[model samples]
Target: MSSPQFSFATTAEEVATAFSNEIKGKNVLITGTSLNGIGSETARVIAKHANLVVVTGYNEARLKATEDALKKENSSANIRRLVLDLSSLAAVRKAAAEVNSYSEPIHVLIHNAAAAIGPLNLTVDNLDSQLATAHIGPFLFTKLISPKLLAAGTSGYVPRVVWVSSGAHAFATGIDFDALRKPNKEGYQAMVAYAQAKSANVLMGIEISKRSKGRVNGYSLHPGVIYTNMNQKPESIAEMQAIGILDADGKPSTEKFEWKSIPQGAATTVAAAFDPSLNATPGAYLDDSTLANDKVGAHCLDAANAKKLWEVTEEIVGEEWVF
Candidate 1:
């Protein structure tokens, strides 16, 4: 099947046009935004439409700058910043706790911050950095803030959590159950690790949605590859170049692929967060801004795996979840 291309060229204003005054009072939080990435643009767009926009990243200065920029666009916009390092469980937990302090309910939580690397690395907790940042940290963060989301709106409908996953997840043959803890000397297959992390993200979303049972929505989306930093990390770029995946100028090697502009890359995330029509399908995989029935590998879609991961994550974080 031929894959369709989507552009992220849409500006923040263009994407925000889809939303209406109904979204005006909604509280929205976006993770992984920095000055130059898609997250910054996501923050820009959310700040325009949502009542409150909580922007988060590891860089304090950049976070403040993005917050300021958003404020300039919408002075009435309630914009805040949280410096979070998703690779660290301690930081993630702290960030979650801080997010819970807000009295207002969060209408939408976008898990858009994730990592792609060409080398195997470990976090402070000795877990795979990619996996922790992409799956575990975001998972815990969502669980922590779910109550706030539930409190924001009616009991029947709470906030939605959208996991910004990647189509690369289709490449994970199966999850490495023990590999997450044990160091594999296989010399860092960036593609495999990225795929595994993304698959886990999808599974995590499904599990969270199942637990919510339509009270809230959860989505795993592959927002067609935009030429964003997340997809072109330094190590991965070197690895791709060595393998002929990229050309001399570092462009994707003549592969039939969709490269979205920043706004377009963020389209599905914004839609999932604010689109009321999607309320019915609380747990679904989204691709190219559409509901996807693309059958993931058995393990990627396995309820058993999701539960195991959840249980193990709780053990790692050493806390009881309120959500």
Candidate 2:
């Protein structure tokens, strides 16, 4: 399981082409696949080789758009559009049920959806919106669809969960248990919440690797700094301009931060999903396109926090994951 020679500049199509054997005929489910996003690009390339590609989003119309886009990339693609709002448990259950009904093993499940860094808002389940959408909902969805992943493993296919985290996870040194339980207006900062949620995604990878007991592999990664809908907020654009990420005319620049194109941004995710080199490390955190050895923050390396988050999420979702 030697690491492949891939860099931040690699494109998703390149990785998919390189791993065409691995991606061929596999069933992949990806979340947050709206147009002009990394998830959509990842799905589009995989659809070129996959037998079934399920594109998911919170909006039905957007999911349809993603489905059409994938089909355009591969005319023979078998695409399924699923509406999944990660903020709601009910929605997660419904989506999981739809997936389970397919009777096909899910060879790869990519949690590419996330809530934006924003003001404090609680879901109907009384949890922080960011935490619920980014971690808790994906946690529950993974658990619910795990049987399909395990089924893939039983059939001699390597089933893995790819978590699309960020290097920004360095913002928080650890998970905020209190904030997850009770998100209030007091002392709430958007970046901190975003950090915790992103770190939790990495933690989920760690715990899934430990708990899955070799039946499933888990991976998390930073997809470089690709400007997508996730970071195109009005205030964020003004701030980016101040930091030289955007020029005076509000166009992207290479002055301060080096950015990636959507396909380049998706390279790590595409590699994590199909690259056999990553099989060596079950709970791997990658940056650029390979292991994030020095780049990943200390907070993301804590196995204890990963375990605790797994347990707490079970309580939040009111369903135990024993596999």
Candidate 3:
């Protein structure tokens, strides 16, 4: 079948409705989910047709709220709540163990939460806050959950891992494994740190495909700039102002970017996970709900860097991913 044409104006519900067959009977999981972000909206759409939808976050109340909201939207929707804080390796390990206990394959996994536009703060793992939340934590979680993803793939479902990246990835041109090992607080710049983390997110799409040999497809996307909770922080706004994204009044400047609504922001992510057309290009990146590899930085697409990231990540996480 020819790929359905979608654009920036499309909504997650539209794509979910269009690809309801792909979603039917599928069990999907999304991280960083809450009512205030794209993850919940992505989960909402998937829950409309998916057999089971697992929503995760660090906050138990927020996960419960997300569960209530999804159920309100579709009473028959099957929703499971998991507490996952991507910035914490300890939390990642605990969550990974919980997911394994269920013993069900996750047909689609979306790494949608991120810690962007923040001051440098190191986690217990000694990784920078932005890098740990946006990349390393998700990287480790994906590795730990590979058994579930592989089970789905072996069962004839084309399992996928989707990383929601950002256009701000252009702020960095390369990976800094040393910085991840030893965060340079004195020289730390939020944009650069966040950019490198997002860049790692893009590379996951590239590397996971090669590692899994197409059995578990990987995809990355830019969920168009939106005013989510990530943007509501004063520090986040200050960082955006430094880059001319927001005005002195903290409003999105129309000249520099066209911000998307929450639903529109999640459209590309939904398409990345459920669009059958994406199966043809396992590790491709998407923008505005369309395949747009040219939109990402060349550094993020480097095959050598992708491989290096996979290796360094295992060491940083202190675990081996044999698959």
Each model's lDDT comes to 0.75, 0.86, 0.89
Between prediction 1 and prediction 2, the one with superior lDDT is 2
The alpha-carbon deviation from the true structure for residue 12 of candidate 1, after best TM-score superposition, in angstroms, is 6.2
RMSD of 3: 1.2
For residues 192-213, write the lDDT of model 2, one tens digit per residue. Answer: 8888999998888888888888
Estimate the lDDT of model 2: 0.86
TM-scores for the candidates: 0.89, 0.94, 0.97
TM-score of the candidate numbered 1? Answer: 0.89
Q: Each candidate's root-mean-square deviation in Å?
A: 3.7, 2.0, 1.2
> Which candidate number maximizes TM-score?
3
Q: Order the candidates by TM-score, highest first — what do you get?
A: 3, 2, 1
Better of 2 and 3 by lDDT: 3
For candidate 1, the per-residue lDDT at 280 reads 71
Give a tens-digit lDDT track for model 1, residues 165-246.
8787888876776766554757668778888888887887788778776667788887766676764777678766775657
**lDDT (Cα, 0-100) at 29 in candidate 1:** 86
